[model samples]
Target: MTPAPFFYSIFGLYLNSNLAIPGLIVLPSVSKVDVQVSFNEFPPALQTNIELKQKIWWVSRYKDENDRPLVTIWQLENGDYWRWEYGDRTEFIIDRKGTQIWANWPNNLTLEDTVTYLLGPIFGFVLRLRGVVCLHASAVAIEDKSIAILGPAGAGKSTTAAAFAQAGFAILSDDIVPILERDNHFLVQPAYPRLRLWPTSVKALYGEEDALPCLTPNWDKRFLDLTQPKYKFQELPLPLGVIYILSDRTTSPSAPFLERIPSNNGLISLISNTYANNLLDKKMRATEFDLLSRVLAKVPLRRVTPHADSENISKLCDVILEDFHKLSNNV
Candidate 1:
């Protein structure tokens, strides 16, 4: 007998897939499915589609031993699907409608490696196609509202969320934050219940690097399990209360500091840190700009500069919670 598909909900969409996403929380059974994931074989339509005018859509910053881009995308002329190639081992074809994904990978390539690509950029691209404005940020629940932690890679977005989780706060999302506009408020859609951290971060948070299990055997990165009793994962969408842009860590402060950023600068930061930004078209950029402009009018954007000392992480979380309290009292 054939095995049943796995069911999960993330970024407010019900996912039904033949391949189980390890860190994502699984649901028993769902009546509605928003996205379907298939691993059988590549669809014929992808090969038959004519090349679009812009055949090459994106290239990863990372490179292979041959010095070529590790990941390259070929945007099909058919406008029906986008093909993503990661290294030489894995490839995924995503439909333009964001409703289906077809994936292929060699057995030599660890399943975790394929899942790393799927759960990160692949799913982020799907959310973009579905008209959700996504940010390269992490979100955590504070009181009744959500706080979005925005930064480039290595800027402590996930680390900050993990720190909050250790303090009993609920993590709304990690890495890619999906934003939805409803009436006058912008809400945050939760991602999976896992936080990927560098070994250094794990050591800082848990007293040792081995405190959490390695995300994959080939990777030194460890992941914090939010499903564990001590941690929390927020499932419901919460209204965004603030956006905190993390600046470079400094040594002088010995503590994290927060300041309100100018609206113009905040908008620029939002555009720069948007998820799957390299693949967005002019129309998508325009929509994102408009939506974020309105969000700035209501939600404040602040800059946070943290101490370089990894041990000061708890102090960082304390500063953010205090800021949230002030924001709440003012309202």
Candidate 2:
């Protein structure tokens, strides 16, 4: 059977994949989809196995310079080779060029589970291979400004962005936010129209915990479906206004607040918030540092601590908007 190609757009690029990607926007044939990939029976494989050093693992169980490994990398004679054992009976093999990914899974495994992991961190790694500076952040467009919300896991980057959505702000991207440099400016490229949220965030936003569909069947995490025509996702690149690194209230003062980060510290924070940054090699790290230097010099950066309860997200949004205007007027 000749499987018709499925076309979608994401991360400011067109994608033509062999399988249907749910929650992705389909475009006409005349539309441009730059990157092409396929999920077929067999893709070209390495002729021979070379030495592979354990780059990263499924879990950081130990730190003895070498130990248990899950996701391993091998510099094949032809190109880069990656192997992932996701433990859900799902596995993946990705080529060096970031153009192809081969998935393997147990027969009983749900398709949702396979696609979830594949698209999340696995595909983020592929984007890293393609040299996109992916950030662990979410963004919203306000007054034509791309305000990126940066934070570590559980820091409410997506949750905060979802609040912006509830407040009638258009979401730009969530989770893996890709940034591109063009014409001497840093631009936050628009991604797909989906925002993943936890049960608590879903309930807080929609008042119905189970209103939206799960990101994957086995996962409790739900996502905002922008395809409904109601939630409009920003579709073009916008020059970044500032990257607000979020801090938990437990570690912050009583009330929500924002603080300016020194340029040097901002550079460090930028590197720390980068998506899949741990996988960067020495050369890649050097390039990343250079990019960060330029970005920090050009774009504004700040740190924000939201109220502990997190119920009144509107207040936090108000503080951010106030500061954004202050910064913008000064600039």
Candidate 3:
């Protein structure tokens, strides 16, 4: 007999999976299943009836030994399905409706290896396919609203969020932030209850290199556990209050500060930091442009430049909370 499927909730969607996904809070049962994931054996090559619409050259920074793209995606069945191929011989098929996912991998890899991609890029693309606006950022819930930390990969987005967690704030989402516009404001959905951080950031925030446990035995990434009382994880959506675009660290003597940016520049930043951005087709791009345009008009955008010292995470959080409070008072 087959084992019972696992139920999980994330990005405001109910998921029923054939395998238990790590880092997610498992629910005993869900009222409705919005997405289903199954693990099955697949051949080395896939055969499809529909014509291939488009092939994304590459989506990830890593590349194969041959210098080719580490990951490639094929839009199939006239956008009804998406096929992903990885350098390590892992594969996944997702429906455009975002309701179904099937994954297969080689014998050498474990479920944890596939899960890293599944939880981040795979689900992020699923959200995009479902018409949700997502950013490659981390979000933290303050008093009544949340703030999204936007930046490039090494720009300290997770580090800043970890600092906020230490300061007694609730983390809404990490890595992939899903936002829904409701009641004339954007609300951020809560992701899982952990923050993935590099060793450098972990040392900076917690004063030790091994402050947090490894996310997976195969990976060097560490994760800050939000289930601990020291950290808070927000389960409900919070209206987005502010957007902070993190700039590169500054070694100058000045303290950390926020710089207000123009809407046009902010829009460029938003477009640049969108999740699964490389896979967006013309129509999807248009939809994202319109949604972000509206967000720019309504939300306040600030550029935060932090000190070069890693231990200054608290100072960075202080400036951010000060600005967040000031904005709240003005509103």
TM-scores across all candidates?
0.94, 0.87, 0.92
Each model's lDDT comes to 0.87, 0.75, 0.87
Task: Please give the range of 10 consecutive residues that has the lowest summed lDDT in model 3.
Answer: 42-51
Could you give candidate 3's per-residue lDDT for residues 1-331 as a string of tens digits?
Answer: 2334799999989998888888899899988899888876432234544234556534678788878678888776566678898888788888878988889888888888888888898999899988998989999999889999999999999999998888899999999999898989898999999999999888888788898898777678999989987789999999889999899898877758888998768899899999989888788899899999999998999999999888677889999999999989998
lDDT of 2 at 234: 87
Model 2 lDDT tens row, 1-331? 3434787667766677677776777665536545565543334554343234324433533333344443444444344566665544466777777766776678776656676766678778777877878788998898877999999899889888988887778888888888888988888888778898898888877788898789876679998876666567888888888889998675345558888898767878889999888778776678778888888888889899888776667878988889989989998
TM-score of 3: 0.92
Ranking by TM-score: 1, 3, 2
Badly placed stretches (over 4 Å) of model 1 are: 1-4, 47-54
**Cα deviation of 21, candidate 3, in Å:** 0.9
* Candidate 2, backbone clash total: 1
lDDT of 2 at 74: 42
lDDT per residue as tens, model 1, 107-166: 777778778888899999999888888999999998889999999999999999999999
